[model samples]
Target: MSTPLTVVCWNFENNGKGRPDLRAAGADLLRRLAPDIALRQELWDADAHGHKIFNEQTRALGLQGVLGAESCTAVFYNPAKFSVVRGWAQGRGPHFVLPPTALTLRYEDAGPDSLPFNAVSYHLNYASAEQRLLEAEWLTTWADKGWTTPGRSHHTLPAILAGDNNSYPTSSPGDLPLPDLNTVKNEPHRLHRSYAGPSGARLPDTRPDTAFRTAGLKDAALYWATAPHGDPSALSRTVNASHTHGPDSRVDRAYLTPELLAALTGFEVIEVDEALSDHHILRLTLNGDLLSDVLAPSMSA
Candidate 1:
């Protein structure tokens, strides 16, 4: 059996310029996913120039996690399930003062195997295409570096790269030269659905097809199809044009290395329509045994 891991990424869209309750709202959105780990973008903290909110809300919601980077880009993991091994942040200078923006994480699960996994959460600058390319280069370079741990040349643990990339996959139109706009002018056709299948089941299958071969690192990431709305039968928020800004776009994404992808049993993305922020959450599940592979350098690359 594959390890069962639920991972998600979301753009809270709260740049500290909106309503005061956004913090609470962001926390509420996470509450719905119940994910083992979560990566968030556009999150502001009291330390940043415009950020007035701290992680108080996230803490209040039982997701009390912290990273060295500022609040704009952050990671939250369940202490009950995993332990942090190593973490760092990138994109911190004034020239690129959006937020720390990128994070590299190494975590160990609580299971007997003590398997480890490396994951990163990043938010790119919403500037011109040229600028985005520079950021994308940085991410690709980092991914290429792989992960290293004590007594291990590389942590082969399944590596996951997730967050509000801001860069659309090749399947979508990333060629457009517009960066000022927050939404994509030509979104991929796959995002049109309001939810997943009737049973709310889909697997991670963002394989590289002819059309997606050159989409950069995004092509390296796979999206797990999931049920659109949570607990469809339960009382939840309804997602529509006005609320989520244009027919709900699944801009947030999660990716795993091909080796890691094969090790997992299932992965899924959740459409948390109304938990806190406008964006929906994503989830991924992996086989617990495969985690052991991560500890071996031969498996990490």
Candidate 2:
């Protein structure tokens, strides 16, 4: 049996003006959560400030951070528990906007025989729903082609993709009920662009949820639906109440492969007391024994 592993997904809203003391407070919030792995988005990497904040947060949490580029998106892991075997990025173009990041990670104590699994940190395009949908389709296709394993189809491993998806699941109980216009108008453009449109235009189908399902990826939050400890009320609360970007909208999400889903033990959306970021944090826990299963063949060989 393996111990439980904790993973967190958060978007720091690291851009904009008058956002006071965010770096320190964000680091502090992460430190408090102490996740084994963290997927972060909306990090402003155009300058040194973003890098500085990433570094500071990693130091405060005692985790090792990797940014595929200056800002885009980032992944951080506890060095004592895991190490990155390889890291890379995927995006729309050579200079893609907020490209997705991937890391192949192996458990530190699994010895030289350990097998690595892929962890992706993604932040879909925020300006246009059509663009975000395209990004999601590209991501699903990438997974279908075994991009994680590069040229080796048989070597493809299980993966977990988490970050600020910027769109809701199509299968969600109901449409993400929009917040009051007054509240949304003052918020960032990225938050409402997917759901809100011209006065008479119908809302676009912003379902990264459907795309992920079609790709054979499973929602971590849905794992609760079948577990013995699962609570429908709590699950509904977590899904409906869990808004990552704005207080009333849920844009952040995590998805896992069926293999990884088998190891899921717990999941929740953690509410932060302070205004560290406009988004809340998502937490996922899994059985560490899953790592052993993935590496068992190599160990025996």
Candidate 3:
């Protein structure tokens, strides 16, 4: 049997200066997609600019906050369909204890391969390439944490690292390398990069296919074109003059392990000619039994 799971990754601007009706847009997207899991970044605290707007929007959508950091990255889900057993935050400075960088949880019918899966949302450093690389390294560390030995108990179980890694796939902008498909295919949580050719160039065609291995397992680089608002009558004025001839610009991504990928039902990137924010939402469908744990008591029918 297949289960339908929808996951959305988006960097909703914390300061609500871009769009006046930002909350409405978010609610509309959520309502239209109705995803089972949502990985969000750039979320400000209640004191922040758009926090109230976002809260109201999500509150209206009937989604319950399952896990989050002090108020940065967070995960939300449809409570009626799934339950959040536990969660934590990560990414506090060295001087202070880091927040739970990831949100860990289990669901009622999450599926046959019931391991604790992690859902992470983050905002890599925007201004510094060094910071971006540092964040990437941090993610690698995070992804490699429990995979050391199969039998050892992990602080957080097997996880699906999903978010906006501001760092480009290639450390620098204009080089291409043939990636190991074996690395990306048929493995549980194989580290995969969406862009392969260059750091600043649009996403390369060599990125993993949306469909790989099993009918349920798959991955892909979703991209699109967008530019600032321009002249009223000149169509030419609206197009981005620089990098206009490059492949799709891939700024958002998702990495599902073989086990989780096998649960994928379907996926798509919501194509927007123009986005309310600088980024677009990466949405996909996961079909299978919800993930639960061996330690938990069976739910009574």
All candidates: TM-score: 0.63, 0.78, 0.62
List runs of model 2 lying over 4 Å from the truth: 15-20, 45-50, 90-96, 109-111, 141-153, 173-201, 233-247, 294-301
Using TM-score, give the best candidate's number. Answer: 2
User: Among all windows of ten consecutive residues in candidate 2, which has the lowest summed lDDT?
Assistant: 233-242
* Candidates ranked by lDDT: 2, 1, 3
How would you encode candidate 2's per-residue C-alpha lDDT over 6-64 as one tens digit per residue?
89988777632224366667777778887899988776842375566557667878999
lDDT for 139 in candidate 2 is: 64
CA lDDT scores, all candidates in order: 0.48, 0.66, 0.47
Q: RMSD to native for every prediction?
A: 9.6, 4.9, 11.6
Q: Per-residue lDDT for 228-284 in model 3, tens only? A: 321111111111112323223445666654444434444455653344555667775
lDDT string, candidate 1, 49-142, tens digits: 5333545645654664554355667677777667775554533333333443333334454333343555667665543333444444444443
Q: Which ten residues in a row have the lowest lDDT in candidate 3?
A: 232-241
Clashes of each: 15, 1, 27
Please give the lDDT score for candidate 1: 0.48
